[model samples]
Target chain A: EADIYQTPRYLVIGTGKKITLECSQTMGHDKMYWYQQDPGMELHLIHYSYGVNSTEKGDLSSESTVSRIRTEHFPLTLESARPSHTSQYLCASSPPGGANYGYTFGSGTRLTVV
Target chain B: AQTVTQSQPEMSVQEAETVTLSCTYDTSENNYYLFWYKQPPSRQMILVIRQEAYKQQNATENRFSVNFQKAAKSFSLKISDSQLGDTAMYFCAFMPLNNNDMRFGAGTRLTVKP
Candidate 1:
């Protein structure tokens, strides 16, 4: 089983509330990523980190921000959550420098901005 | 920029039948990686199979197999004897050898009917 974990499998918050989605992996992977997805839709990359203290935005533009303070932890924060920010957020990690290897993904956090 | 495309929005297969899902990608890199991931209702992304662009042989796992046409930039997943447990959203992904991020296509929702 994959060692990655995401907390709060589901979240419902009022608009303008600040929310943070937590992601952590125990596999010691150097690369971590965050993706946004909607029901029955494709996943859009929002942010990624090459290692601790490193972060980069993905191809898709996103209002949220992410932090990689530690190698195993990557967290995404939405300063003022809105209805448009309501979507499932997925976290994934892969071994360092193995482009051929697939990622191990978390169970995702389904956020609902009411 | 690399882009993956899954033309089918939804697909269905009867129990013990076979099904194939098509995916195509556009990339300037000659050597890269392709993947098929399955996300069940539980919202966990599971790696189903992967293919290396440099390898001519298609990759297969128990009931899952891929037909990878490097020249055509086409990768398709074939499920043999589909089961109800196979019901999920299937996504095609591409990762260039030089990049750490994987680009995903709009997913295809697969319904395995009993």
Candidate 2:
């Protein structure tokens, strides 16, 4: 079955360590997004990509950057991890936006930076 | 800018009972979409239901349904015959018809008791 996938379901890293969260969808959706889920269980959009080579930051500002080099892949990278960065990262994808479309989200990656 | 809000921070329902989670959004655009998502303890975000602003009828999926009041800018989710698996953090989201970004509300944690 076609689905979105996020690797490293859980990660623990030291402060200042560089890390990448991988997100890929086999559905061939044109739009993909990354959301940071806080301890309060609220989700905040951090980044999104309309298509390959087109990426933009979302409402929530973050030190991480994302790249969409392939239609199926959108990866988020933190140049240097910090304790404050510890949270669940969720990746989602939906067919080109504008119309009413529901997203297919992947099981998030729980990152804990010490 | 669009903003989504979930008034209830937490709620509980006995198994086989019904529960409603309220969600309100602020948006100037007439054409938009509303969504309800469920995040389980495992942290997998799942789409529960969706409602279109242009449609007068509410959307329903199995035991889940939505009460969409476009004039009031309110969209709420009603879970019928709640089960153990229904215990999770529920989030309300809003997306404009012309905008690619989606705004999510702080979730409401729902616990289904046996």
Candidate 3:
């Protein structure tokens, strides 16, 4: 199993509440990504970070924000959650050198906004 | 912008039989990487196989193999001797060589019936 871990495997909250999903990797990868997926559907890239202090929005627009203050930690937060944001959030990390290998993913956090 | 497509939203195969999943991608860059990731019921996204765009030979790992038709912009996966354990959501993804962002196709849910 990969060293990557995501806390709160499942979450349910009110629509207006602020929420944070935690993602950390012991692999010390330089690149980390967050993807949003509906049940049994394709995944959409929401956010990503190349390294500390370097973050970018993905092809899909998202109200959520992410911070990469540490090489192993990339946490995503929503200032105000909504029902439309309900989805499975996946975290993945990969090493440097563009090898295209070593992409380790976490189990993902399933969020539901009521 | 790079985009990946998996036309098959779902597939089924008898135990011990073989199955193939289709994936196509669009990109202007000549060098990139393709990957197939499996997400099981547990929700952990696992990397199954990967192929480099420049390589002429398709990538294979045990029972998983890829048909990389670069000119056709098609990358399909063939699973040999299917097993019930292989039942999961399979995703096709692409990553450009110089970019850190990876794009994923809508997944194909594979069901192996015994």
Best model number under DockQ: 1
State the lDDT at A20 in candidate 2. 100
Candidate 3 off by > 4 Å = none
Residues A1-114, model 2: lDDT tens digits? 329999999999999999999999998899999999886656888998889999999888899999999999999999999999999999999896433677889998999999
Return the candidate ranking by lDDT, descending.
Answer: 1, 3, 2
lDDT accuracy of residue A112 in candidate 3: 92
Predicted chain B of candidate 2, TM-score versus the true chain B: 0.98
lDDT by residue for model 3 (B3-113), tens? 999999999999999999999999999999999999888768899999999999999999999999999999999999999999999999998988766788889999999
Best by lDDT: 1
Q: What is the interface RMSD, in angstroms, for predicted model 1?
A: 1.6
Query: What is the full ranking by DockQ, best candidate first?
Result: 1, 2, 3
Question: lDDT per residue, candidate 1, A1-114, as tens digits?
Answer: 659999889999999999999999999999999999986567888999989899999877999999998999999999999999989899999887764688999999999999
Interface RMSDs of the predictions, in order, are 1.6, 2.2, 2.0
Prediction 2 TM-score vs. true? 0.95
Better of 1 and 3 by TM-score: 1
